[model samples]
Target: MFRARSRTGATFLALAALVVSACSSGSSTSSASSPAAQAAELAALPEATPSALAPYYGQKLRWRSCGVPGFECTTLRAPLDYARTDAGDVRLAVARKKATGPGKRLGSLLVNPGGPGGSAIGYLQSYAGIGYPAQVRARYDMVAVDPRGVARSEPVECLDGRKMDAYTLTDVTPDDQREVDGLVDAYKGFAEGCGADAPELLRHVSTVDAARDMDILRAALGDRKLTYVGASYGTFLGATYAGLYPKRVGRLVLDGAMDPTLPARRLNLEQTAGFETAFKAFAKDCVRQAGCPLGGRGTRPEQAGRNLKAFFDKLDAKPLPTGDADGRRLTESLAATGVIAAMYDEAAWQQLREALTAAMKKNDGAGLLVLSDGYYEREADGRYSNLMYANAAVNCLDLPPAFGTPEDVRKSLPTFEKASPVFGEALAWAALNCAYWPVAATGEPHRIEARGAAPIVVVGTTRDPATPYRWAQSLSRQLSSGRLLTYDGDGHTAYGRGSECIDRTINTYLVRGTPPTDGKRCS
Candidate 1:
């Protein structure tokens, strides 16, 4: 979710300029000219129809013994095409831990921790599948399924590990046309690498397509309705499912919801500002600590921002060597990326300070590189995971490209800079990578009216670096049944990170079907 930097409204607004270009050639054909009318039309989408689910629901589930006690593994076969049920089959990897207590089971509770690329099965087995409250676990079967084009579901691949090392380190903000060409080439190379490696699966791995797959999983699990918890991009996935299958939405929690109506560029730009907000929170806290890298005696976050930018400027000219076996050198862009990555979870803020101190005081960059590698999901054997590659593919498919050219990016730099003066330039350029994608996007910005659904909780953190708080607000307003749950703290997603209030509220909801009160606040 941290790596999917394009979802913020700032980037969407920046990309809005390109959206204008793409839309200029395309016609709306509809008579609804005003936003009000368009919204009403969207609100009128028909509720999902209930079809008798196939009897082979549990048959496809090849249940196997899992590493964790009382857990079972299964492979679900779904048609690659929903429109044609007889088409070629695509396999979904699913895991579940059955109810352990004496209470009768409520139903299967599906979980997606988000990424669009985040491995839900991994997250389930590692965190949500096991760590959820015992009461919730006793009444519901904890289940997770990796989305299509994601891990263990016919994953997407791009450049090799070495090539990816170079790609992530490339300077996004170019000073000259030659440098701009280099950046464009980098974008092209990344796109081509994906095209070369996963051409067949790329087009089918979209959010809408994945939502359909979720419906299949819903039926295969023998649940009459879909009960789900989705975070970050996962919220978008859940909302998309609700939009497509409102009648099937039983109990839903969309934490850190992404506003589906915003275009790509605005999404990226808003996320840039979101990171700035999170950094400000970190900076304010950093000043209270001793040995603060930016300043110790009542310095503001803006001052810290100034100092960090200056430090990055110096690294652009002279990168720090990590002295690792991979020979991975830390450049300014990569270092900034690392900093933004840590800003997602406030728990890592202390480590960010240590990383900054090492780079500024001792010229070591190992700490920062570790953060970067974690964001990239790089493995110890020097092999890179396809997280970023799949992130871009699904993101590009979810909405139109943010920009059409680098010039469009150049035009939006000032706006991005104004939004986040510290990380603006790099983020502005990162938003442009989609402009050169090999395939045209199939989705457009539109509000999802999940009317008739049960009260769905929408969680937001005031200083969330990935999905901004405003997005949660927008999404809450858009959903007829959305209940806004506020976590007035820091992190990517609020629930289960470390908030007892949040955990209890969501757990109670999952176990007893009692949604939290609307507009509830948690520390």
Candidate 2:
């Protein structure tokens, strides 16, 4: 998922997470940190940094004024492969906005808006740098680092614009063997493209590596310990940091947290259900509104779901025409993506409704196409960003594939369908993309018990589609010092999404080292 950039401060992470538990350290059994696991978890955390990475830890940064006013940017070199630092190097992009403070300066507060591939520098320059609370900014520098293989960092490339356009439309809800073969081919072609365009980098962008980079950034910034905020996939990054360098963790806030303990199929299935939860919320509100095209007054949510599913089925059979000069039609893949994209935040519900109205009622598919393009970051000139590519890349490499073969997917269909009948098929098939990844996975499902870490605040949205709320609960439980702050509302993340309760609690923790009361609920 791309950053919900429209809302300032939402430089929080967005994107589906790997479902399986991992023993890879960063995403290792990290969904929840239970109190019962505290003693055992502390005993289990990785015993501190290895000797091979000392050079990276000792490296320094050279900062300078960046493109954004009031912010500075710099490049730092890290080993492309930590296992072999003498082999090659990777340049990480960093940005920071110094606090305009009356309060005494604390330290650098590193923020990562999670895409796993999200541009942390871009987020800092555009949102978090200026958008965070004034007090926090006054007391601490807001820093962002585009993890290696993302944005200004040595980004990983997979497909050309045209090739990707075809790739995106490849059907996920394959109905027959031929469609399944085509889907398999699509996955193969994408994997091949990445291998061709970024052979060296593809194998190196795992979350564990990124967490190590964060420690390097912390040392470079002169911070004794890391103080940070991360959302969505960023949560996993933060959790991993604590796992690897538990002693180095400072005040950390994980918003829209991900539970890495579940496998990809389980993650996808739960996300489908989470989206249904958000949809029901939207549907309930939709029925009470005027001009609600999905339904009339008091129309049941089940009926609304059926109507939307019917629309998707119609698009599968005969895509509706869009106003694109390229004569592109709204395929079922695009339409389904557009629908699920809105499930990230309630802010997009209005736009989604309008798009749905045009496509389903008026047979004009342009609005829905716009939503899909925005999600994919497609430009007017037809180019695409590397978001989806890296999303697949990192996810595939972080853990084993969700389904090894179509037969495995076929076997799992009933369970996925049972998870979210409407979207089970697409989500299940989407999980297959990583099955054909060129690289072998480096991690496995396992729990993260950052045993010696300080208090880390974990936030969750009740109906977050990408990172389910239960993930926050699970992660908070698993962490040795996790404090679960529940946002009893919708949206991908809680902080900066119009909740004074959530913001104040997080701000207090960040500024005062005072973790919120565990199990605190914010509306």
Q: Give the CA lDDT, 0 to 100, for residue 451 in model 1.
A: 75
Please report how far candidate 1 places residue 217 from its true position, in Å. 1.0
Q: Which stretches of candidate 2 lie over 4 Å from their true place?
A: 1-52
lDDT tens per residue, model 2, 1-523: 2343321111111123222222121211233533234322323334565677777777877789876779888887788888888879898988888888898899999998777566778778778888888889989999998887877888889888888788877878888999999989988998898888888898898888888888888988889899999987888888889987888899999998877666665566676677778888888888788878779989998888888888888998999999898778999888877777777788889999899989988999998888778777789998876666666667777877767789877877777776676677776676666677888888755567888889999998888766778889988988889999999988788888899999999999989989998899999
lDDT of all the models against the reference? Answer: 0.74, 0.76
- What TM-score does each of the candidates earn? 0.91, 0.92
Model 1 spans with C-alpha error above 4 angstroms: 1-59, 66-70, 84-87
Global lDDT of model 2: 0.76
Error of 2 at 77 (Å): 1.1
lDDT by residue (tens digit), candidate 1, 1-523: 2433212111121122211111111122122333222433133334443242253244456689868776788887766655555556678888998887779988888888766667888788877767877887888899988888778888888889888777877777688999889888888898899889877677777778888778878877789999988877778888888887777889898887787766556666677787789889889988899988888869988999999889888888898988768887888877886787777777888999999888888999888878777766788888876667777777776666666778777877888898888988887777776676676777777778777777888988887878889888878888889889999988777887889999988888877788888889999
Best by lDDT: 2
